[model samples]
Target: MTSAAIIPSTDLDRPELRRPMTDPFGRTIDYLRVSITDRCDFRCVYCMAEDMTFLPRADLLSLEELDRLCSAFIAKGVRKLRLTGGEPLVRRNMMSLVRSLSRHLKSGALDELTLTTNGSQLARFAAELADCGVRRINVSLDTLDPAEFRRITRWGELDRVLAGIDAALAAGLAIKINTVALKGTNEDEIPSLMRWAHGLGMGLTLIEVMPLGEIGEGRIDQYVPLSLIRARLAANYTLTDLPDSTGGPARYVRIEETGGRLGFITPLTHNFCESCNRVRITCTGTIHTCLGHEDASDLRRPLRASADDALLSAAIDRAIGTKPKGHDFIIDRRHNRPSVSRHMSVTGG
Candidate 1:
């Protein structure tokens, strides 16, 4: 693994850079999710089309620029930083970036440094990630059946992903399985998937598929509201609502039978945007204050314009000022097109 050069700069220590980022809704934005790359190893039917056109390497921000931009956010009181991607692990020398950002964890400037991965590469990087002050991670796994997994991911191997999950568990990393509740594909597997995840002492989060992009398949056929899933599960199992949150949009409940926690991300059936406290930055340095909206501010220009962060900070402030009260995400037969033209991979999940 290549080691990123760690440079101590006075830019983040400036008095003007210490203010907290607050949105127009009076919510303190402390969480920042950065997509290190738009490239992934899997072509999940809901996330991407079978044939994808990724961004060129030159279009992506270098590790140094990403570090600087993240540092600016850390200075602005971002307590949690999540490195997301089409698959963050697939990026070359990604550990170097993780290593560089681990300094914030040591200095008490950040509360958490983690990532959401597909788990295909976790077997190789889990140990190093655990060494880098990362205590937990979220792995996207839609189905547990080998054949069903392959069908959903399009090119993934179930055994390999399972191996990666085992590796992460052995490396002392708390794993949360993020399953996109697909309508006809894997809806029947929800109970078994939840049982398997909870049986391993891991948390399971069921996410309602959002209408993000055109993935060759109609999203109306794939969209499954979590309200129905929750209601169905409540009838068969004991689901006690809990006020616990892990800093994202998931609402949690305790499963009495499994003695484990289960989370629901109901973006469609329920609008959890009222308490939105995070923003996403694509690999190209475009910051989207709301995921369901196309409103974004370009940070790459300001970042490359000067070595100073004044320009970057001002750009961020302008974006946050216009953060929408909530996103307008709807999926129906009439609306076959995506709400946001950009793929969920491009905007960072």
Candidate 2:
């Protein structure tokens, strides 16, 4: 029941420790995104294909294995940890993991622990998560219109998501609304969504759609750049630049009258490779150096074979060293990576 003990820099910089993970670009790797499970309840068109296949349970990493991997990353100087999913809460043992991470937070082994979910199952776990130590929660909510909600999710109800949002807010969790702006779909609802987020005192981020694995053919048509969305927002209100503490790529702005903030994640329009300090691990323990290029090292094999942190750190060092200067998809529209073939869900969006 103690406050966040906060991991100290001294422990990570011990003399006997392995060399810190620094890429060729001189970026210090400290952020880790862990995808606990690949199974998601809702089928969002922009994220997963309508007809999708999930990983078998046997292939998924066990809780103990996940704990070992996480500990190894923390030992290597990772400060911020984000638990993502196809929808993390859908996994039965997610809360136990959350509680364990909460212990790590209280013990100064981890700094910040957060989660990103579709919010379909949030109402049931919001209070427990916040009480345990999850301070930040990002919910992917595209539209407020019930009919559009159903259309985008294929079979989701808007009220349920709104209730989940309310539940998270009630639990005193810092909520950020993540909306994917599509040309014909939720583009027009941007302002409305902003007002809604502002009304609830939450920040909103508008993400421009990218052509990720099997997001289905019309990416060229569906793509809506932030430049256009920013213009629409500026026309209605004055925006002042607001830098974020979270080293994420989203460019944040404060609205004029309401004093609310808006975050724009323009992966296509702008790439944040120079400051990219994060690495992702799939549920099965594959370390993906970059989100765009799928070249990954099967970390599970090494973890299962050995428990030595020094050895684990060496394997991770090799993966971090391989990070490309930047993702090519931003420049090359049809860019394809031979190394990565799975969708964002499997990659842990």
Alpha-carbon lDDT, every model: 0.90, 0.81
**For residues 111-158, what per-residue lDDT tens digits would candidate 1 score against the true structure?**
999999999999999999999999999999999889988999999998
For model 2, residues 1-349, the per-residue Cα lDDT tens digits are: 2332323222323445546678888988889999999988888887777878888999999876776677677777788888888889889767777777676689886788899998888898999899888898899999999899998898688888888989999999999999999889989899989998998899999998766666554566677888998998889889999767466678889998777999998888887677888889999999988887868898887777754555566788888889888875542355432223577777877
Q: Show where candidate 1 strays beyond 4 Å.
A: 6-9
TM-score, model 2 to reference: 0.91
Number of the top candidate by TM-score?
1
Q: What is the Cα-based lDDT of residue 116 in candidate 1?
A: 98
